[model samples]
Target: MFHPDRPGPTRTNLAIRTDPDQPSDTDPPSDPDRPSDPDPPSVVMRTDPDRPNEDLIKYGWPEDIWFHVDKLSSAHVYLRLPKGKSIEDIPPEVLVDCAQLVKNNSIQGCKMNNINVVYTPWANLKKTGDMDVGQIGFFRQKEVKVVAVEKKVNEVVNRLEKTKVERFPDLAAEKESRDREERNEKKAQLQDQKKKEKEEQRMRKEMEELKSYTALMKGENMTTNEVRTQNINQYILINN
Candidate 1:
C-alpha cells in the first residue's frame, strides 16, 4: 500500500518538532569552560513544558499572533493580545519585539544574515492530525521579515530586552500606585480644607467678641473710670 507518488498528507499548516535531545537557543551550553549566559530569554519559567500552551489559552486570545521562523527550527512564540483586540490593533512595538524574539529563538538564527518569521492568529493554528506535544500548524500564511542583526541591535539598545516577556504586570502595578497616591492626596486636601474652616471660625468669633466690647465701652452710661476698669477686665479675659 506504499504509493510514493501520493506525497505524505500534503503537509498543510505544518510545523517541525524541536527535538528534546537537541539543545535549543533557549538554554545555555553544557560545557563548563564556556562563560554562562546572564539572561534567559526564550524560557517562560512560570509555565511547565506539559502545558506551555496554557499561557496562550489563558492570557492570549484566539486573535493573538503566533510566529515561527520560516523553514527553520524555532521556539513556539506567541504575542499576547487583549480579549477584544484584533491583529490590526497590535502596536508596532509589540510586533518589533515579537520579530526579535522569533529571530533570536531560531536555530543558528543569529549566524544567518536574515530570517523570515511567519505568523498567524492562534485561531488559524490548527492540529488536524496527530501532531507531537509542541508541534502545531498555521493556516494564515502571513510573514514578517527580519534581519538577524536587528535582534542583536535591539538587545544592545535595551538590556532589559533579554528578560522582557509578553506580560507587563509591572506597568499595571505602577498605574495602580499612581491612582492610590492621587486618592491619598485628595484625602489630605479634604483635611486641609476642614482645618482652614476651623481657623476661619475662630478668627470670626474673636472679631465678634472685640466688636461687642467696643460697643459696651462706647455707651454713654459708663463713666471714664468704669470704662477703664471694663477695658482692663476685657483685656485680661481676652488674654486668658
Candidate 2:
C-alpha cells in the first residue's frame, strides 16, 4: 500500500508514495549526467502484482514516467513528475529510488544483479485491445530508457515504504475532468489572443486615421480652420 496526500486535480486508485529521502550509503553513486534536485516534490506510484489495475495505463497523464523490470514480470511503477518538468529532468536519486522499488517488487529481479530497468514517458505507452490485462507496449521503442540496477538498496526502499498509504481514487473521472479543464483553458487562451489582436488592429486603424488628420492640419495642407474641420469631418464620414 502506498499513499501520500498531495493536492492536485487528478488522482488515481494506485499505491502512491511521495518525496523519498536522499540516497544513503547502500545506494549507488549518483549519475554525473543527471542533475540532483535538493527539494524534489514528486510522487512515486506502483500497482499490485496480485491485483493488476489497467486504469493506470488508461488514465496516465503526460507528466508520468513509467518504470518496470526489463524482460520480467514486475510491478508497474510510475513517477508522477511536477508541472513543467519532463522525463529528462528526473533527478538521478529519484531514478534510483524508482528503479530500486521496481526491482524489489519483482520476484526474480529482486534476486538478480546488473539487471536493467526500462522506463519511458507515459505518453509513449501504447495499449491495444489485443494485449492482456495490465500489459502495454511502446509507440516509439527508442524513447525507452534503460537503467542498470546492480542490487536492491534497502535504505531507499525503507524510506519509501514509510510513506505508503492505500487510496482508491476515480482515475477515469479525474482524467476526464482534467482533459476538460485543459481544453477549456486552451480555448480561453485562444479567445484572449484573438481579442488582443482585434484590439491591436483597432488601435492601428485609429492611429492611421489620426495621422491622416494631422497631415491634413499641417500648415502647407490646411489654408484655414474651416478647411481643417471639413477635412476631419470628411475623414470621419469616410471611415464610418
Candidate 3:
C-alpha cells in the first residue's frame, strides 16, 4: 500500500517499506493493515544482497540513518526519517523493524542468534576512493549506535516485506536537485531578510526626519514678528 515516490534517490532495485503504524511524538499508533499516509516514514534496503549499491552510500540524504549487521555481511538498510526527526528520535518499533530487515537480508545473520546491529546517521558515514565498493568508515565512531537483536521477529519482517516496493532512481541527479533547491531556498530567505531590514531602516529614518521637522516648526522654536517688534521697542527704550 506504500508508494515508492519520494525526494531522495538510490540505485536500481532499491527496496522501500512504508510503515503506517509508525508512531510519532504527536500522533498515536495506527492500524498496520491500513494504507500508509502521505510522507510516512520508510525503510530502504538493497534488493540484491550480493551486490552493494555504491550510490546508496554516496548519495544518501542527511535524513537517512544507515543500518548494518555488526561484523557481518548484511544488506545495507536505511531509515528515511521525516523532516525534523533525528536518529535518536526513531521510535522503538521502527528501530526493530530496520534491524530485523537487515538481519533478514543477511545470509549469516538470518541463521544466527543474538546478533548485533550497528546504525548511525548517514552524515557520519565516511567513504574513501581507496575503499572497495560499498565499504564505508565513520567520521565519528561515537555517533554510531548498537542494538542487540536476540532473535528474528517473523511478524515484523513479514509486515515489512509485505509493504516492500522496488524502484530505480537516478541517485546523482536527485542529490544534485535537492542540493540546488536547498541553496536556492536559503538564498531567497536571505534576500527576504535583507529586504525586510532595509524597509525597517527606511521607516526609522522617516520617523526621525518627521520628528526633527516637527521640532523645527514648533512655536517655541520660531520667533514671531510680534516678539521681534517687542524686542526692538525694548532695545530703543533701554537706549533712550
Q: Over the stretch 1-240, how does candidate 3's per-residue lDDT look in tens digits?
A: 001111233266555555546643433344555555555565566545556677887888888898888888777788888767898888776788889988897878899999999999999999887766657689999999999999999988876666566667787898899789889999999999999999999999999999988887785546676688899999999999
Give residue 103's error in model 3 in angstroms: 1.1
lDDT of 1 by residue, 62-154 (tens): 444666666665555665554457667655545555556556655556457556666667677765445544455655445333323334445
Ten residues in a row with the worst lDDT in model 1?
10-19
Sequence-dependent TM-score of model 1: 0.40
TM-score: which candidate is best? 3
| Candidate 3 clash pair list | none
Scored by lDDT, model 3 comes in at: 0.76
Poorest 10 consecutive residues by lDDT, candidate 3: 1-10
Instruction: Give Cα-based local distance difference scores for all models.
Output: 0.49, 0.75, 0.76
Compare candidates 1 and 2 on lDDT and give the better one. Answer: 2
What local lDDT does model 1 show for residue 28? 29
Candidate order by lDDT, highest to lowest? Answer: 3, 2, 1
